[model samples]
Target: MSISLEQVHPLIGNKFQIETSNGIMHLELVEAEERPRRGVPESFRTPLLLIFAGSSRQPLAQDNYFIEHPSLGKQVWTIAPTLADHAKGQYQRPHEDGSTCLYYQVFFN
Candidate 1:
């Protein structure tokens, strides 16, 4: 199944179990950008983008870069997905309140 931001709303504020190739992955969406602040404060909080490659055993890591958009001005916090040693798996984003915002079941073969 494909995962999208709108598909996981039910799991937005809660922790849920994600079935992955490696095992059941526990994910929680912690939080999203609470409010927007004015002025350039050097940085701004961007929506969390979580990418999970089922076979990865180590901690997921990625670099967050920034770009300036004509409408949004400065766009920051880009989630770069770096796949681990394995292929084919599941991914999801769960919120602290037991809601999930995104989920995907991928098959690599």
Candidate 2:
């Protein structure tokens, strides 16, 4: 079955696990954004951008990772650390609870 925004949208704020050499790292789904482009056919799915917040302040190196969710199962994708749209003034900012967290981003197109 194909994964769609509909299936992932509600998953925001939920935990997703990523397998790393350090073991299984947990991430929380933070944002899901649809980016519509001109000239793209409606038959093609709009590109979706997803961002996840990790509890660790340390950033992970970019690579293909096996990320899993209970309902979404396991899938491999290129994951990279991002500054979370730093222009928004959230770069390296502590979370609501004042805990520092790093952000990662993945794209689906």
Candidate 3:
């Protein structure tokens, strides 16, 4: 089944796992933003932007991954490595986890 913005919005800040050939990488959903409406105006489901943060100590390749959540089940999505903030640098995640790392984003549009 396709994942919708509504299904994931509430799960922000929760832990999610990404399955890669290297192994399982742990990540946290850090940001969610509703994108501008498209297609059938407001009647259509708005696109969404979801950002996830992972450990900076390890390397995370950009690829399609099967993301697993405790309650959200499993869904595959294409995730690309992105900057947390251009001014601040892309690799370091802007979180208070006492550690900084690279951030990844998934586009629902």
Candidate 4:
């Protein structure tokens, strides 16, 4: 299912347990901070990006996560059960009527 950025931002740095159709997905918002880079031209400026994700079990595993920024974009990442398993989905976008919608599903089992 899809969730809004506003709805999820407050939960950063906290543990989250969500009930999915297949099973429970345990997520922990590890760290959220502004990523800084040096070497870029002074004319370039990056929007504030926030990162959030779930803890993993594999050795040296990378956390399942998402990155969001007002101007850049939003992205979600999760581990695949196998190379053959790939799912597609979409995210929420606000409408002219001020209504929000979310339509996405990512497999993490």
Residues 1-109 of candidate 2: C-alpha lDDT, one tens digit per residue: 4667888999999999999988887888888888776678888878888889886544589999999999899999788888766775557767644667788888887
Write candidate 1's Cα lDDT for 1-108 as tens digits.
223345444444454344334444543333222232345354534222343322223222343334222322443333334432223222343333444333222211
lDDT of each residue in 1-109, candidate 3, tens digit only? 6567778889988989888887887888877888777564765567889888888765577788899997878889898988776664555444555667678889876
**What's the TM-score of every candidate structure?**
0.24, 0.82, 0.77, 0.28
Clashing pairs in 3: none
Looking at model 4, residue 71 earns an lDDT score of 35
Q: After superposition, how far is residue 44 of candidate 1 from its true place, in Å?
A: 21
Candidate 3 stretches with Cα past 4 Å from truth are 38-44, 86-99
List the lowest-lDDT window of 10 residues for candidate 3: 88-97
In model 3, how large is the Cα lDDT of residue 18? Answer: 87
Candidate 1: segments with Cα more than 4 A from true spot:
1-13, 34-109
Q: Tell me the whole-model lDDT of each prediction, alpha carbons only.
A: 0.34, 0.82, 0.78, 0.37
TM-score of 3: 0.77
The segments of candidate 2 whose C-alpha lies over 4 angstroms from its true place after superposition are 86-89, 92-99
- Model 4 alpha-carbon drift over 4 Å, by segment: 1-9, 16-23, 41-75, 78-109
lDDT of 3 at 57: 62
